[model samples]
Target: MPTYEFFCHRCSKPFEVTCSIAEYGRKIKAVKCTKCGSSKVVRRISAFQVQTAKKS
Candidate 1:
């Protein structure tokens, strides 16, 4: 499973959900806004950091 970030249009809030890749690929439309209980949610691009070791 992977974490996905979403933005709620009804409440103007951001949230995250962890689901299987298969479920995401299938485009399951069951995501709901935790704050406003709205189904109008959009996926957001999440930023991640990668650390590299210094060469000795």
Candidate 2:
């Protein structure tokens, strides 16, 4: 699962949602805001976490 960052226009707040890429693509309609329950949400460009093994 990847954590996606989103911003709510109605609430003027930011939030995050963890879901699979397939599910995200399947979400044709706009995502609902966690705080204000508004569908006017947009995905935000955020950093991703990368895990690398130590060189032993």
Candidate 3:
């Protein structure tokens, strides 16, 4: 699962969702607004987490 940032076009609110890539893609395709309940949500550019393993 990954975290995604979404901007609500209706209410102009920004939100984050933690879900799978497939789910996220579906949600983004739907573009449903969470705050104003409108199908006009905008997908915002988000930063991905990076992990580094220690060299033992």
How do the residues 1-56 of candidate 3 rate in per-residue lDDT, one tens digit apiece?
Answer: 76677888778889776778768657667756656777777667643332222332
Clashes per candidate (backbone, < 3 Å): 0, 0, 0
Tell me the lDDT of candidate 3.
Answer: 0.67
Q: Which candidate is the best by TM-score?
A: 2
Give the better candidate number (1 or 3) by TM-score.
1
Number of clashes found in candidate 3: 0
Assess each prediction's global lDDT (C-alpha) against the native.
0.76, 0.76, 0.67
Residue 46 alpha-carbon offset, candidate 2, angstroms: 1.5
- Point out the worst 10-residue segment of candidate 2 by lDDT: 47-56
lDDT of candidate 2 over 1-56, digit per residue (tens) = 77778899998999988778888876626578989889899887743332222332
The TM-score that candidate 2 achieves is 0.70
Candidate 2 displacement at residue 45 in angstroms = 0.6
Each candidate structure's TM-score, on Cα atoms with residue i matched to residue i, is 0.66, 0.70, 0.61
Off by over 4 Å in 3: 47-56
Whole-model lDDT, model 2:
0.76
lDDT, residue 34, candidate 2? 84
RMSD of 2: 5.5
